[model samples]
Target: MSRSQRPIVAFLYDFDKTLCTTDMEDYAFIPSLGMTPAEFWPEANGFGRENRMDGILAYMYTMIRESEKRGLPFTRADLVEKGREIVLFPGVQDWFGRINAFGETQGVQVEHYVISSGLREIIEGSAISGAFKEIYASEFYYDAAGRPVWPKLTVNFTAKTQFVYRINKGVLDVSNDRDLNASMPDDSKRVPFTNMIYIGDGLSDVPCMKMMRAYGGQAIAVYQESNRSGVEDLLAKGRVDFIFPADYSEGTELDRTAKNILRRMAISDALAEENQEQLRAIGRDELPNQARLF
Candidate 1:
């Protein structure tokens, strides 16, 4: 198929647990602060609860304060350097390439994106950072001296939904709210909801998963052994379509299910296009009544 003829399918993922084994900060950032994950997370949560601050911002702030106490530099470079220590889940390192290849063979153009509450700079430092077309996450703005000063962006759970819309409209720039909110025709949008899939781990991802369910997309929850029951709850509640071990290895349930979804979306796109063509053939401008087909 020609470039324009190929249907575009998007895979949107949460970074922390969906792709990696644990929270991004647990890898190296917390350790560098001379604090364990147990201590750091609780303190951050406590601060948020006491001050009525957003949890994501509270953690970012805690990072800066703790770094200062330890005489560690909280520069963008420092945080990114910590990302080097992140350990991705099994098969994650090669998952994108294989999925992209499979999509190509299916006449689908695959695009990957990360909508996370973790630090964007840290994700940028990871080995698979370049695989995503866009990474929407919390970020800190540095001062003239290159010291972290303020939160540039904080993507809490609910805020994650906007990035889904951004991906749908191809308005990737986080700073551009005007165009993101502008009304646009469904067909004119870049990628249809039906062609999108969202993969997330837990509660922080509920809003995005719900968006996928409400809209025509598919949502998958990947879980670790410790969180299997929580993930089961999500599936039982019909909040997600499927749950799999946080493994992306070839032949794994996740890998197979993802491919199946891609194929289904590809077939749906083809059918919708053929229906439109049939309408145009008969010189009818009225929208085809076959919306139920796709």
Candidate 2:
């Protein structure tokens, strides 16, 4: 289908456990500090426990402190380079293209997005980073010397929900245009919530998953096969539209489910458009009668 005629279907994903099997930092960054995941997490958690700090903030602080102690460079570029080593789940590299191709066949435009609490710089280093139209994730600020200075943006569970609205209103930048978020009518938004599909795992994604589902979007709560019990729990609670194994293989449950969703959304959009055109034609036909009275 031509670009002008394509119906938009947005696939919003949570990183960490959703896309990658493990947390991105645990894959490379923590190990690069010469500490095991267990060791680093305990210390980080201890600090959070002692200070009553947010877990995400504590982790960021731990990264900076530990990197400094290990004499590892803590620059933005260094973080991005570490991200390059982050491993993805099975079939992830081809998942985007496959989904996009399916969308094309269904006359829809499949757009991907990342709404992650993970560091943005590192995600940018990932092989599949180019697949997303926009990434809403935590990021650090740099000093005049271009060194990582501080966390400029920290996307926690609730904060990540804001990006959902931004996506709806076509507001890409996090730093500007407050009115876009505050005053834009729902009808004027770029993509309706019903056109969205959110994929996530675990508790950090609960708020986002709930928000999407509440707003007419579908949410999938994915879990490893070994963790079928958790999937059952989520399904019972109605927290997700569906539950699927974390497996991303082509023709797997995930792949087939997503394809079916796109097809359904395309049919809905086509029907809506047909109705609109019929209304216009009716109005045109009635114009002659109204003009005769005038």
Candidate 3:
């Protein structure tokens, strides 16, 4: 089938603690700064508090300041190197391809994306970076000397929904505000909200999750064994549609759930196509049910 004929299903994920065992910084960057996560977060948060800065910007600033203070390189390459240390949940490396193939069998095109508050450079270094069509996250501007000089983008919890809208509209370029903001009918969107699925961890994911739920997409929360209670609470609060263990291993609850969602979306897409075809057959394709009076 042609690309235009295929139904597109997008799966958006949060990086830290959602796909991996812990925060991305906990793996290497913090340690390289001579700080433990426990010691580093409070300092970062305190700096944000004292300076009245956005938490994402504050942390990026802290990274630069500390790295410069210690005479560390603190370049984009340094971040990519640090990303090498991130450990992923079971079967994460293979999960994308498996899901894509499953979507093909169900007659849908599955696309993956990362909408993370973590560092884009670091995630770019990850083994699974190839899985995503786009990875939106905080990043830095490097000087001619290749040292990180400034924060280029800071993706906080509330701002994540913007990327979701971008995905829905197929406006992946972060710089194209004109296209992103232009009004488009729901049916004209490249991927309607109902065809999207957002998978994330707890609290920080609530805004995007709630947006997905409100817009007819699926919002699923995945938790670690020790963190199941938090996700359960999210489910209980009706902020998310489903909850499961973070295990991405094939046939696991999370994996099974993902496949099921894809299957259901494919069915919905097929039924909608059939409805359109029938309408065309009956000369009702124009369906003169406009709210406006001619």
Against the true structure, candidate 3 reaches a TM-score of 0.95
* Candidate 1: residue 282 Cα off by (Å): 0.7
All candidates: TM-score: 0.97, 0.91, 0.95
Pull out the clashing pairs in model 2: none
What residue runs in model 1 are displaced by over 4 Å at the alpha carbon?
A: 1-3, 286-294
Q: Extract clashing residue pairs from model 1.
A: none
The Cα local distance difference test for each model comes to 0.91, 0.83, 0.88
Global Cα lDDT for candidate 1: 0.91
- Stretches off by above 4 angstroms in model 3 are 1-4, 286-294
How do the residues 110-179 of candidate 3 rate in per-residue lDDT, one tens digit apiece? 9999999999999998999989999999999899877888788889999999999999999999999999
Question: Which of candidates 2 and 3 is the stronger one according to lDDT?
Answer: 3
Could you tell me how far off, in angstroms, the CA of residue 22 lies in candidate 1 after the best superposition? 0.8
Ranking by lDDT: 1, 3, 2
Output the lDDT of residue 3, model 2. Answer: 30
